[model samples]
Structure formats: structure tokens, C-alpha cells
Target: MYSRISTVALLARALSDQAESYDYLLAGAGTAGLVIACRLSENPKVSVLVIESGPDVRNDGVVTSGNFSFTGANDRVLSYRAGKAVGGRSIVNGMVYIRGEQAQFDAFEKLGDSEWNWDSLFSYGKKGERFEGPDTAQKTAGVTANPADHGTNGSLTTWKSIGVNPVTDINGGNPHGFVSAPQTLDRDKIRRSSSAAAYYKPVDSRPNLKVIQGNMKRIIWANEKKNRAVASGFYAKEEKLGVKVKSAMPGVGENMQDHNAMVIGYGTANTLVGDTPFATLVTAQDALGNKMPVLAASSRSQISTWAQAASTYTGGAIDAKTYEKRFQIQHDLIFKQNVTIAELFPTNLGSAIVSQLWTTHPFSWSSVHLKSLVSFDDPVIDPNIFSLQFDIDMLVAVARKEQKAYSTPPLSTFVAPNQVLPTNATDEQWTAYVQANAGNTLHVVDTCAMLPLDLGGIVDSKLKVYGTSNMRVVDASVIPVELTGHTTGPLYAVAEKAADIINNDS
Candidate 1:
């Protein structure tokens, strides 16, 4: 229903309706924008205009795979909201569903305000949930609903994948084993449609709901005081076919941020060590039913067996060389309870795809800010990946730990048999390797945080922008604390509750 609004018509309408502003003007159509738009428009009386910087995601095969198969389908929009796309990044994520640790949110409370504390904020976490998993790991991992942990009925269709990767434990036996299972994706199809698809797509028919496609340039305020400045709207321009792309007028821009990642590649199959002090927070053991000794490394491991049933490329979009490089399989392992997960992309090609070590829950911080004078043009992104002190230290330690896991009996027998990761195996050797490799998990967050305004927080406890009267942020951006699970599930819950709050207030 929203796919019809064009740049020309949108501009014409805005010029004519400056005085009678939309009850709500949400900038960007990524995770947060979709939620705010869907929730606010539940009431037919209030007019809500959602400005997206990209195109719709209705028929994109790459976005639908909802798995690793299509993760790189679209270029990363580190610059602006997933350019005008209706679904935003939810259309491009690992699809793993997880909630932040209770202690984490409690820390937010300690660092800032009561409204952000675990006690008060837990409800919203649950409210946005649509639990369809068997809760296999729930009891084992101490993840259960206490009214604050989960929600039963939400608009998003959340569930465990009917199809699971070989690495994940489909049956709730050993809680520690790595299993690759599809999350937030339907097994019947490869695509991972987001809440925007399930929730907003169905209700765009409402007259009050108007989705306009344009590059959001800036966030214009009505007054001088930053907090008092009511967010009026944003500037937008159409992309030119070939001629000069028109410049948009300067105004307010949407402030976005995300976590940057550094992937560490190793030469051998070995277990990485977990964060020392951090180990106490977890409980680990060998795969259930297997007598194999459980290595205490710090990363999580998953065995993914899913491959694109059909060739991803029709002609030569991806040459055979590229396909071989991306599709090689290697053994996987998890260490240190489950802080990180490692995948071994095996290949007889060059060095033999040994083990690919990754630092889960990386501590790096970065952002997505506007590039031009307008917020609508793609935002400039640095993800300033690897900026945190703890981030580098963790990489060094994990590399050492993985080397140890490879030394174990059963795994060692299959691994280089003798040639393992960190071959020289010393603090120096591991450190050099760490410095050389390490990319992002692509799990970005916290561009517009939800907390009290006093603590440098943009959004309030209710997820509303602090200074605004009627606006709210209901996507991954509103998430103040980092989530232990992937961001999509939590985003769903956030949007669900946002809908309730707006509806109740209306």
C-alpha cells in the first residue's frame, strides 16, 4: 500500500501541508521507522507520515533468504537508513534471536535512570515477542519469562526454524553444542521477512498512514532549544537517472550509530579462550550424550548445513572462484560456555580452510551519520570498528584459547593433525594474527538510544525522542543496551509495545 508514494507527489504534498503537519513525522524506514509507523497508524484519526530513504523489499530474493546465503545481497547502508527499503536491516541480518542480559539493562539503570533499569524495562522486551521456539535452551540457559523476559502475542511472527543447521542441537539435549538454525525466517522459503512485512504491510490501507519515498536530509525542529525543538519533518530529493543528482535543502538529519566488528582469521583449528572474569557468567559442557571433553574456550560454535538449494547466480554474477571461496565448509566449535561461536570453512584449495575465529559480543563502537548537508543522502559510517580497548584485548586472548582447543585429542586428530592455529603458539604470534584479521558481526545497534534525556539519551524511557511530544523510536536504534541475542527479535518486541503505547495514548 505504501509502495505508491513517489518523490514528486511527496514533495508537492509537503509543500501544501506545512501548517497542518502530520501527527507524527518519522524519518527513515529501517527497523525503528517501520514500528513507529505501524503502531501510530493503528488509530485511523492520527495522520502519520513515514519518510523512507530507499525502496521497498517486497520481491528481493536476497533479502528473503533470511540466512547466511544472502547476507551480502545488498551493500551495507552504513551511510543512511537501508536506502528507502520498507523492511530496513531486518531484511539483512544474521536472524539470530536473543534478548540482552538482565544485568546489562540493570547497568543502564545504574549508569543513568530508573526508567531504564531492568525492573521497569523488562516488560517492553517481552511485549515485542512472539515466541515460537520450543524453549529448548530456555531452562538450560536460565532464559525464561518472568513477565519481563518474553511476550506471548505480538504482531511479528517469531519462531524457531523448522530447518536447522547441522551444528545446532535441534533436540534439547546438550545445551552447550553449536547448532545452526534459521531464526526469524520461515523454512518453507529462504527469505527473512521482518515485522515491517508482517505488521505494517497489512495495514498501510489506513488513510492516516502515508509512507513517502525520499532521501531524509535532516531533522528540522520548530524551536531554538534542542530539546524544545519539536521534530517537524525532514528534507528529501529524488535520485537522478543520469544527470546531476539534485542537492536537497539543509535541515535536520537522523542520527544513527552501530557496533563495528573485526573478524580474526586463524591458520589452524583450535579453541579460543574466553574472557577470564567473564567466564563466571556462563556454564558450559560437551555436546549432550557425547563423552567428548567440553573445551572451555570462549566462543560459540554452530554447524550450518543449509546451502542455497538453487545456484545463487544465474550467469556469472559470482564466478566459480567467488562461489568456492564463500561456500567452503569446515568443522565448528564453541568455547567458554557460549560467548563466541567459531565456524571452520574447510577447503582443500590453498591453505585448506582451517578455522575462522570470531569474537562474539565484540566491544567495538561506531556510527551511521549523515554524509551531506541533508540527512537524506546516505549517512557517513565509520563503525570505527575495533575502537574499544577491551575489543583488541579480547581478540588476542580468544586467538590463544582457540589454539588450545585445537590441541585437544578428538579435534586434534582431524585438524592439521599437527598444524593448528597460532602455529608458533605464543602471545606474540597470536597477537600478530589478531591484528591482521577481524571484521564486523554486522549486528549493529544504538544509533538513537531509549533512556532518560538527562543522560545523553535521545529517546526517553517510553522510547520517545526526549524533546518530542508525540514521536517515538521503535527499532534497533531505540535499544539502549546491547542484546545478547541478534537484534531482530528484540526489535519486534519493541515495535509491538510501541504500538500499544501509541494506541493506549490515543
Candidate 2:
């Protein structure tokens, strides 16, 4: 069931006999694109075509293996990483699956998106996952799950790692405490269960669907002068195969956003052991402990500063009032709601423990635009990490707390006596260290934000571009807000809901 059209000649021949126009044309065969294509192709009447930049790397070890390297900019300002294969970042990311907190989704509802609350979107979450029960060893280690919260039949497979403690369904209402979450792995639990494997492979045999390996040039617009623009098709370039195909769609590439992360690495004397890549996960309160109030106060005091910084970053695209409101929403999530602010990854490197500290969210904005019309030219991506003062301050605070965690109890007993990176440094020195060493977590979203057009929204709630008809952006770019967990879990849910919307449209 894996039909890969790697050559332009084969693709051209495949499309020559078919209708000139397809019922649906997807611009990227990555995470969101694959899900949308699979669901839309369910109906035999519809013809779906997906154009992807990368080739069919289904068996590429660099992509399929859990220990994969990054490919993107590593400049002083920001270090951005994105996958160049069919499954996108899913094939390269650390497979930790977290659905995020309920409060985060409720915040989306308050932001003029009534249909995006936790209750409404929870089903989509279940629809895309097939959860496996924890084994005897895992259950003995305190693993727990609620059967009602998991999906029995779904494309994606998930299971808890061995020797990890689990809480009552991490997908349920609360994810505040320590819990061992599931990962996107196959049944054998060796290879990664990427979107290409889960959603695309199962339905590749359908004659109605075609996946072409190529790069999308730009969205072709039907009417540019109209109040609401309409799309016809798009131009794609496949240089290796020497093909240039024009497919349909407008509002193709516009909005782009990425999660900005600061990694605080600590060298420990004792080797912290774990079968998987990550060992323990600490929430904001868990990491900060008694110092939680300091963060809350800091968040409150920086409301105006945040608003001004965001407004400036957007070039006044977001008004002062809207910026203020957005800051307030983020503040409430950080302070009142008590969402997950930091994630800790403990790894044993030979004789020392290298613990990675990541800030869950960093408030910064940037975009991705084509530098040239050529297919080989990479798109210009600017995440603008640490553009705001608040982001730096938040990351510094989290790093300080992570230092404290390494110094305490069971972990401290195992770790080395002396510090590694900022050894016995002052607060100012630690801040400088963070600025110099912090890197992104590779969870990018909200470029094509789902919101009202008045608020710099490129796509509607249905994942359809505002000014276009019959064209939708079903990628991580549509996510307007950052989630407490990884991007993949929520992205699957978003794509699932998007497919439902596209099908239900009259």
C-alpha cells in the first residue's frame, strides 16, 4: 500500500489521464497534509493530490530512528530545525506525546474561537491515537491509565515506556503532576510511527489519491483584486526529476510560527540511567517549587512590557488592546491556571549526567517566506528567539530553578558533587550563560494562525484560508497559541478536526 511517485515522468503520466482539476490538492505531504489527504480520500468520489518537497524517505535511518540530528540554521540569534522528509518533524522529533493542559484550549475559546475548547476538540485527539496498555513491569512501576480517555482503533500507536510511572490519563482534564506519558511508536516498539506511516501508508493504494515528490513554489491566485481572494492552483518544482507541475491552490504559504526554547544542560557526577531518551518530567511548580510565586509576580509586572514588545514585533499588525488582552491570557495560564512551564530530560553520558532543561513556551514571533521562486532555494525562516525581554527573563528563571533541582534529594545523590556549566556563577553570570547557550525545541506553529482575519489571522477555524475558497492549510502553522506539551499530539487532533470540517462543508 505504498505507491511512491518519485519521478516526474511517472507523476505526469499518472495525472495526464485524470481530470485537469482535482477535488482537493494538498501543498505539503508532511504531518498535517498526510492526515488531511488520508481523510479526504476516504470518499471514493473525491480526487486528492499531495505535493511534497522531500522524497519517500520511509526507511531513512536518519529520519526513522529516534536518535536523529537536526538540519537548519544554527546562527547566534536562533537555531531552527525542520525535517525535510515526507513525515516532516514527526520522523525526527523525540517521540514524547503530551496533549497539553485544558486551560490552554479554553484560552483559545476566549480568543474568539468558540469551537476550539477542550471538550469540543478532545474527540479529535482520541480519533487519531491508538493507545496500548502498559505492560506488567510498567504497571508495577506505578503506570496508570483511564480506558475511556484512549482510542481503541486509530492510525497512530502509543504506549508507555518501560520502568516509568504513569498518572490517570495524561490526556484527561489535569496534567499538573509527575507522570510517564506515552510515545508515538509502532507495535513492535522499535521504529518511529510517523504521520507518513500512520496516515499516508494505510491509504496509499487508493487511486483517488496521488503523492508527488516536489517543492511548492507559491499559491496561484484566481482573482487577486476581489475582497476575498480565490485560488486556482499552484506551481511546483522538482529539480532532480526535472519537472515543473502547476497544481491548484491559493493562500498556499503565508503564516509561520515556531516554539522558542532555551536548553539548560547540567553535568552530573553520577550517571542518571534511563532506557528511553527522557527520564523525568517536571511541571512549572515542580521545577520552581517554593519559588513559583516569584515567576507569577514577574509575569504580572511584565504585562505592559509584553504587550509593547509583541506589538512592535508584529509591526503594529496586532493593536495595543489586542496585545494587552493576549498577554493577559498568557499571564493567566502561567499564574492562575498553573500550566506546565518547563520539561526536564535526564541523560547519562558515560560518567556524567547531562540534563536538558527546556522552557515550555517563549513569547516571540517570526515568519517563513520564499527567498526565490527556485525549488532548491530554502525558505527564509526567522523565529526571532529572545526578541522580547520577558522571554529571556522567563528562561533564566527556569534555568535557575533547574540548577536548584540538580542540587536537591534523590537526583542530587546520583549526580556529581560539582556543577558543570555555570559552576558557582552569580545570577548575572547565569543569565549570560543562558543567552549564549539556549536553543529552540523544534516545535513550530501558528504561521497560518487560526483566528479572525482582523487579528492577523490567515486561516479560519475550519483551517481554510481567509480569502480563498476550496483551499485549506492543515498544518501546525494554523495553531495560534503554544501548547504546554509537544506539538505533534495537538497537531494530529487539529488535522483530524480539519478533515471533519472539510468533509462537512456544504
Write candidate 1's Cα lDDT for 1-506 as tens digits: 01111121235334553333566666667765677677677767777777775777766776666435211101333322342487777766556554444444454555444555445545665554554543464335322223323455610011111111122321121222233322565534545757566667788788888777766443444443444434455445443222222212111112222332333222334433311000111111211112123322121121111112101211222233322221221112122123223221112223332343344444333445545543334456655444433345555554444444445544354346333344457755644445455555455555566644433356666565554554566666666555443566556655656666666664
Model 2 over residues 1-506: C-alpha lDDT tens digits? 01111112123423342324576777778887888889989999878788777788887776666553322123575546676778877877777778777888887778777699888888998997888867786666556678787787810011121112335667775665445567787635467889998998888999998888766654555554355555566556333343333332222333244544544344556554544333244455655567778867877787787767666666665665666776688778776777766665544554665556566666665666656545345777666666666666666666665566566555565565444454466767756666677767777777667777666676677766665555577777777778876899888888898888888883
Show pairs that collide, candidate 2.
Answer: 233-248, 233-249, 234-247, 255-447, 255-448, 256-447, 269-416
What is candidate 1's local distance difference test score? 0.44
Model 2, TM vs. native: 0.83
lDDT of 1 at 250: 14
Query: Over 4 Å off in model 2, which ranges?
Result: 1-19, 68-77, 154-166, 223-227, 237-260, 264-298, 348-350, 373-377, 421-425
How much is the lDDT of residue 25 in candidate 1? 67
Per-model TM values vs. the true structure = 0.61, 0.83
* lDDT of each candidate versus the true structure: 0.44, 0.65
